[model samples]
Target chain A: MQPRLVRLTVWAAVLGLAACKPKEAPAPPRPDPADAAQRAAAAFVHCVEGGNAACIRTGLPHGAFDAFVLLGWLATGSPVAILDALSRELVAHSDPRTVQGRFVREVERLSGPLRGAECSPVGAQELAPMVTQLAQATKARLEAIGMASADMMRVVEGLAAEAAEGLEGAFLVRMSCKREPYQLYLAMVPEGPRYSAIGLMPYLPRFLGGDEAQIDAAQALRSKSLGISGAAAPVPDGTVDRYLPIPMEEF
Target chain B: MFASFASFLLAVSVGLSSGAPDPQARATAAGYEQLRGFATVLVTHLNRALGTEHLPPFVGAPVTPGLIVTADPSRVQLFDRFAVPLSAGRVSPPEPSPECASKCPKILFDTFRRWWFELGVESRTHAVEVPDVVLIGAHRDLPAQTLTQIAYAASESRPIQPPRLMLLTHGGPAGVRGIPFYLVRPGGLTLPPNSAALGLTVTIEPGRFVVTAAARSFGRTLSATSVPELVAILKDVHRHHPNKAAIVYRFSGDVSVGNFVATYAAVREEFPVAVLGDDEPITIP
Candidate 1:
């Protein structure tokens, strides 16, 4: 009887050990911040490549408007086929608070309709607080995404700031020169778009008679009158010619 | 006890081997490996070409350098062509130039205007006639009409814009074209503008349905008409492939024109331009 009882106990032990074989551990939980950042970046790249800016707002995190602005600059190359894809992805995941703040900040920076004189001052005043909130949200999202240390992100942001400033100066100059027949020539330079103060035909008497100093002064007044003080002066003809000669024959 | 131990061992072996992922998964993994190998080869070739040291061979075969003159003098006309004015504040004005700037007699502002209009018409006709392939070239001083003609050709018929590959034979102001142009240095030698004259060797194989451009003489400046003329000649060759095509162009005195003739003979046998996206064989409907 004692031997039989021992055998039974051994069988029970074996059964228990077989039952205890561990099941595969559940897939590790995704890190929320990393996942969100990756998704946002992927969605943004996709939309910009597809050439659909309108679709990018949806996939953005609750406060990441700056990322959307960055997308616009990066989407300039090639056919920009990915923009449409990104827009669809962003819009499907709409949480306005996630992206609105950054959007407004970027608009202000890009001189997007929000900052122009053509926009009513009353409307601007009303939207100021909302814009501020958007900026803060964007900053928070950037921090969350760990974009603070990214060199590429910083360069993109810097370029955006420069473009915004340039656009503002250009707008001012255009307003001041509105009465002149001089037409604006906006050249899309590699870094950003540049506006020539106004171009007049070389054969025209006024243009041919004017000395270099006179031409420079007119451009300066246009800049000052538009309240664009710190803008870079018009590039010298020699330099401009080397870099982008007026394809005069192929206008 | 022995029977139970054997059963347990058998079950573990079965799970380790037969219970592994399906054959389809294994095949997919193999397919991915092959894809990776092909990608590696492509990337390696591209890197070699772009590297700072030795220049890689041209992507396609070489062909005889050629030229075309629109013998039809009646086709020439003139109209307002777009031009960037000299004054800084001026808008681009409509200047008149020759319609056939490439083939027409050189004239000042008036004759040039008429030449531009003719060129625009020719460019449009080329696009319509050869919907599959159109090659264009512009001299350092491309007339405004030539640029507009290229733009017009690029805009016609394709839902999406077709790719434009460009090779700069001269350094000058950027000219407008329907397609994006790349600047290539010939003989792997990079030289500054005004230091060299250049010519492009193009071949079109209509039977094979392919077009190829080879960078021929370096350090030479070709006229704006040279590239368009070369393209027209290639199109003509495509029309008479598996037979013979004639090339006609005057060369600048600076370079050995004979070298171009020999190089084209050697290169023409290899490069042929085919329909876009038809690099591989397919059965025509």
Candidate 2:
């Protein structure tokens, strides 16, 4: 009886400890969205570095706000990372709290197409908060759909330096910039009900010989060097041109 | 020199500390191929259920499908017409419309959805907080009559105020009897404006004996009153038009076929109507 009583006391003590410990149901695990956002931010920066901003803006026009957000995301990775990025982009004359406080405002007010068109795009003053939000939002959005962040990361990771014809409404427009030897091909994407800018018009720096025929020929040749067909618009001169049907081959 | 070193160190540290891998280094031939598959999947996911089905290869800028008004949701259909002419990647030479035909609920929605997803479109205002990429489809000056008509439409849509909406014309086929194409925006917005908005692009399909036109009426959430007014306008247009069909094409950003069929049938009792949910492609109905 004494040994059995001792065993029962030990079991009760263990049960009491189990009750004291907080037991949480395992939520379906989610990859930190912060990671995915950071990657997207990194990819945008890498793409920007590889291509010209003017050229990219020609496609995205109003500077890639998401990319800038990612840029901030990368800069202010955390409180620790913010020490460097925020310190540099921070308005020296302004209070640090004020600079930090500015993030509460929308990213659009800072550097969206509206401001870009109004000739008042985001500047150094708003940079700190913008990037911080970019990072946070990216993380939050991806986190919401446990799989969305991963999938988008894969998409961004897979992005090539060609026209962004991934979505259904993307197509190529050959713009005759009036007497320019090399016409331009605008990789136009759908902007709401209407279509958006001359986003993906790639320009080749090399002087083309007289024999060079097409508008995006140089870039086409370069893309060929990379072993790829020219993206959506490669200057169709005649009345009729070829259009790859929607859901274009991914690459 | 000390400042330079510190700057260099900061730059290097930032580069190193940033959590992303060297994407440039991985951007290779094989990388593109791997990316291609992933891109398809990612696009599919972004498009949601709309991505699952295969799209028939037709060669035209997006156009509206023939409309058939029916009470039955099952009877609703949408389709496409391809190999049409494209100018600046837009359907060209359309205003109040010059021509007609049938096929594809897509072209307009293709334009609408394309705009909906790609552009950082906010509500009616530029105030939508998004990465805005405003569409400035190469502008075509509106004929005075078309502008007058637009003013009338704006007044009808917003009865309390002077019409402040604007219009831009886009893609149509080459030849006689081309359709009238126009997209409505805020009065001051221009092609390549600072930002983009999700508005209604009304395309009066080139032919008759079908619906007269299509408009991007709503996005995501459909309303009972959202498209019926436009439907009435199309009927009014048909009354003036020589060729008349019984249907008009309408599309929204994120609505399903079943739900739209159910909703419209309940709300719109006047016409024998058919609807296209998000499940299928623009079929040749």
Candidate 3:
């Protein structure tokens, strides 16, 4: 009876301890969608600014990257019908993963011009800060000239008016990199819960000659440099002028 | 001789330490030449940075004469264009200088008055032309018309269409504001076609149809208010235009890339013969 009574007391103690245990902390609240989107978008810019290839890839989803590349390629004067047909053929043989890899490589190549550049991801609403930067630049430049106070004010006022007029109705998310003449404006679009950036025009410089000729030549040269062959479409000159098309829905 | 040498050394040392202004710079600050001097200096710096022998001269397009708008958030002013006051503050005029010695301020005022007058006249006249290179002040809000006005003031001087119209915003990287380095113009364009080539102007607006016309040619006037309606008209023209006609785009700097890309894409779709007109080769940033 003593042994049995002792066992019963121990079981009661165990039950009391179990009942007294605190409830587990509630699951962390789901991240807000807007904040998530902003963070996701900014991460891409951060990676690019950091010049991290791996980080860039991680930020870029397959679909978003493809859409960007296709848009830029088609913009280079490729006839829609021709590209539509060529895109199908290119997609047939190319792997989406491999296409993304090449794109990251292309970004790595083009980022040379923008190396050490101060790039900022500007939202549609957050342009005031940048505008202020521009104002400072203007003031310093004008001040350096040693103009009269009134004259300087006049110039600054006019510029301020112009800036006001020009930016009134624009709604865009841009990654503006401070290059020589002002800044390089690259557009970004929201994809699902995140955002993706477009950066390709810097590859097609003007010195290569006429529009069609230059585009073809640059693409062919780019392809050769990348050792890309089977997938890229070859122009009449026996050089590949097109990149492998990764099929993405209209973005 | 030793005393004189010592004094000369002292002056040289003082000048070097103080970074004495050059004669040209000193002269540039005073008189009517100041306006022209500013232009020369700005252009020289732009050319040096651009690696080009000549970029079109900068024509200042201040909104008001004699008054300068600075980006001072403290004081706000209500312009005719805005209902709310702008954060850009005004510079108070200095003590009246009736007997002005430099004459630079007078010249600046006169030049600004003329530009403002011309701009008003141009707007009233509904001139469709844009300038080759316009330098709007270094403010952040690029309202559609301001940066584009850079070329209009210049257009008053040179009526001819330049090979390229480069629309840029002021304020560049630190210490380079005087030089207009921010290029705001759209890119990926072919060289300007011959003057004789037929041209049509297409204005870009987001998610809306645009009506455009061939203002360059009389009797070739075509109209459609929306982009789709205009695209239909251009399709007919492209199908039949004997000479490969070129399409010139006229838009405020505020036009989005999506709108532009869509418009360009639509034009490219119909005009497989390719009659797009622009001054420079595709020199995008």
Q: lDDT: which candidate is best?
A: 3
* Runs off by more than 4 Å, candidate 1: A1-84, A87-93, A110-251, B1-148, B151-285
True-structure RMSD for candidate 2: 25.2
Rate residue A19 of model 1 by lDDT.
Answer: 88
lDDT per model vs. reference: 0.26, 0.26, 0.34
Q: Could you arrange the candidates by lDDT from highest to lowest?
A: 3, 2, 1
The docking category that best describes candidate 2 is incorrect
How much is the lDDT of residue B222 in candidate 3?
57
Superpose all Cα atoms of candidate 3 onto the true structure and report the RMSD in Å to 1 decimal: 29.7
How does model 1 score on DockQ? 0.02
Error of 2 at A53 (Å): 17
Docking quality level of the chain pair in candidate 3:
incorrect
What interface RMSD do all candidates show, one decimal each? 23.8, 20.2, 26.7
In the range B108-157, model 2's lDDT, one tens digit per residue, is 32332222221111121112212111111111221222222222222222
The window of 10 residues in a row where model 3 chain A has the poorest summed lDDT is: A242-251
- Give a tens-digit lDDT track for model 1, residues A166-208: 2332211111122221221111111122212110011111211
Query: For model 3, how does the per-residue alpha-carbon lDDT over B169-273 read when each residue is reduced to its tens digit?
Result: 232222223221111122222223332333345555443444343323434555566667768877776665544434544454355322443455566555422
